[model samples]
Target: MSVLRINVILFGIGNIGSALINQVLESQQFFREKRNIDLRFPIITNSTLAFFEKEGVKNAWEANFDQLAIPFTIEGIIEFAQNKGLENVIAVDATASSELVKHYIPLIQNGFNIVAVNQNANVLHIDFYKEIRRNLKKFDKTFLYETNIEAGIPVLKLISDLYYSGEKITKIRGVFSDSLSYVFNRFSSEDVPFSKILNDAEKRGLLKKDFRDELSGVEVAKKLLVLARELGKNTEFLDIKISSLFYDDLEGTNLKSKFYFDADILDKYLEIAKITQVKNEVLRYVGEISIADEKLEVKLISEPITSAIGQLKGSETVFEIYTESHGNVPIIVHGDSSRKKTTTIARGILTDILKVAEKIKIKETVWL
Candidate 1:
């Protein structure tokens, strides 16, 4: 057996970050015994403060961070890693901050492979996207970010595999947003007011963005752009045409309020639901790109209730992939959309870490 040591510098101590720490602590032993993988977190950080764990995190990691974390800059992190002589370093980004993305290139240059749970880093300006890829190649470092879209559903990897195999992908479409999926899924089948379900999801910490923001379809569009770029499309973010679920007249009202009063918003969603119901269809916010037309779309469409996308429950997501080999039968993927999503998402991030570890072969052989 060979033992591999994986060191992770985790960013973002919010929901996903905290969950990842818990997962690492809980699974550290299993990986060591079963896989010969010694995974450790030597450093952890949020947006403003960082904690340097000399011996890796313990169960009391949260308490230690409260007592020992200090304000930090990217320069300080690089210096600390250098001074400690940490090897086989991987930086895991679990934050949604665009500013944090500015440091990705620097970290990669400083001998770090990146495992991102962040989407902005992939969907930013196309030039930056290309530049990051160039740097990764130049440094001979691996970058894995399966959780960037579909909450770790492996949809991006599927697309990449098909494209790399010389298969022509005709189109890819799905209900991409978990928050929006839950809201619309409920609205389509139940008689409850949309505002009630929206607020309830917020109370349960299910709404990652404000419910209204999910209605704008910007996040779903970003997912589409990332997938498009994966297909070697020279596409810009602005190139995708977005159709907001909310009408144009309501845009101003949404901007003025963090979560605008929504009794009326309920009416709009209900009206659309009624239209879909009459045709034996259900409302779904879908993102689709037809490569033949060279255009991307994010909009609301009516799907047959018996269809794969329509059968979604809670925040579950599905993808319908169309490729030249499959003809009319598209590959359908179901997301790991458990209501307790932090655990599943953290596991996804951990899977990416193992990918980097296995790829770089930072291992020592031993006879057992």
Candidate 2:
């Protein structure tokens, strides 16, 4: 049997990273036997500690890494991969650190195909984002980041696929954030205080610990910006007008804890919720981009229960893509409200990895 070997250099050994490493180890043999691909994790790391084994680490790498891994730098990792002379080298990033994203261009230039869940790189300055794409083409390397948005719902891939398939995309809209979805869904359906629901979400890890990270609407805005660029719209972060879920009346009283001191902010949400209730609708944090109108906005709006977005339950995310061929009934991709799970995100990263592997074919045929 011939072995098609591929080396993996993974960064970020947090929940998502650890899950990916585990999945790789568990499925290594299956992939080898079924697909003729030998996946190797030569380097696995977090921000400070890392474990390096050229033959791939043992199945129980976590216990061993704690004792064995030494201090290493990104430069060292790059040098090691280069010296190995492997044909397929994939760098998988699960970290949110922008510092690591700074090395993406260089990594691609060094013949390392990248698969990342980090959104920072994809939503970088328009110029830099374009530059990275240019490098990937120039070096004949691949950069797949289908997990960058909405926990690997393949939303970005859906856009690109339709765009390249001769479909004229006119509008893209969706409920984009899990945290926001959970917060608003519960707040709308239940009579619980908005502050209580917000607190519950934060404690349950549904919302960012800082709270404003989701309440400020920046996350949804960033996601919209990423999609806008993909749709060939010339726009930047500032170009999108955002409607914050938090009220402006409480601008200075530490909004993170405002729910405790300022109950009036909750009143604002209640007023909107009651109004929507009378209208027989649900509140959803929605992001929209209209190519024809040249508009991009992220806001907390109410949609009728009959609508695809309004019928969403729990933390589910729904994307409605309007293309010329699809007409008024847009193509929808739905996430099962469980995108925050580490395993799901890791699975998305693995999907991208295999996509890169498919490019490696029989360079030379040999008879046994």
Candidate 3:
């Protein structure tokens, strides 16, 4: 029996990170017995502090908080991993920090595989993306980020598989925000205030306090950037225009004002519905990149029921990928409509990584 163990370094021990740790611990036995793979959570770190154990990390490390002592800096993490003489190290970033990208290149150069759940790194400047790719090529390591986009949706794999099979994607469009979807879906039914729905969502842990990223369409823009990159199109987040539903002054408002304010763009849509004769005037933030003329459009769509985006429900993200051979086909990916769903997507990425790792013969690619 081969007792092979893979050491994993996890960053950001927040809600998403905690869920991922739990899933890893729960599946350890099954993974070891079935796949001959023993996963070890040796180094766990956050922005403030870190904890290291050669033996597997405790599942409830976060609950204890102070007892587990380790260094916190980026250098500290790298030094600890190196000193341990860890053969196989994987860095999982769930923080959504752009700074994490700066750390990944060196880690990969040292032959550590990086799997980032932080979409910021992948979605930002094309130069950064090219640099990361260059580093991956130099070190002969894998850089997989399946969880950066849709949670628990194998959207990346689906696109890659199709592309590899010689399918040409002509146009891509989607409804890609759980928070916005939840807000709009509720707005359509109850005639409730947009701010009220947002407040409710925040209290329920469905939306963040400052949900500008999700509501402003920046989150969806990142997803589209990743998709465009994979399809051999060099694109950046700024290159794609985003239609924001959030008010510029939203950051200044207190929780009390959020319920009373009519600053949100969705509020205008609702007001229009009340006064105008427009039926089923639903609001959806959409991102599209068409290959025909290489045109990219990102805007909030408010149209009739028969329109492509007039029927979005709570936290359900629908994607349409138009290819030369497949034509227009819709792929619907749904989630829990909460922060917890982000963790689910993180877990899904881990699952996909494991599957990919299992397929690569160590003997053939001794460098990996």
Q: lDDT of each model, Cα atoms only?
A: 0.84, 0.82, 0.72
Count of clashes in candidate 2: 0
- Per-residue lDDT tens digits for candidate 2, residues 1-368, read 57788888899999999898888889999999998889888888989888877354455778767867889888888888778766689989899999999999989888899999998987778888999989998998888888878665788888998887788999999898877778777877787777788778878888776766577788889889888888777688989999887677655547766656786666666666656564678888899998889999998777887888888888888899998777899998887665457888998899899988877543324221
Ranking by TM-score: 2, 1, 3
- Select the stronger candidate by lDDT from 1 and 2: 1
Ranking by lDDT: 1, 2, 3
| Model 3 Cα lDDT, one tens digit per residue, 34-110 | 88777777777787777777465444666434677555777777787788788667788878677777888888877
Mind sharing the TM-score for model 3? 0.87
Candidate 2 wrong stretches, greater than 4 Å: 54-59, 249-254, 276-278, 338-340, 362-368
Per-residue lDDT over 1-368 for candidate 1, one digit per residue giving the tens place of the 0 to 100 score: 66677889999989899999888889888988988789877889989999997565465888888988999998998999899998889999999998999999999899899999898888888889999999999987888888888655788888999999999999999898888888888888788777677777788787754455577788899889889999999789899999887666566644525335545764766676566464768888899999999989998888888888888888888999999989889999998775478887888898888888877664222222
Q: Which runs of model 1 end up more than 4 angstroms from their true locations?
A: 55-59, 253-262, 269-273, 276-278, 362-368
- What lDDT would candidate 3 get against the real structure? 0.72
For model 3, where is the 10-residue window of minimal lDDT? 330-339
Candidates in order, TM-scores: namely: 0.92, 0.92, 0.87
RMSD of each: 2.8, 2.7, 3.3
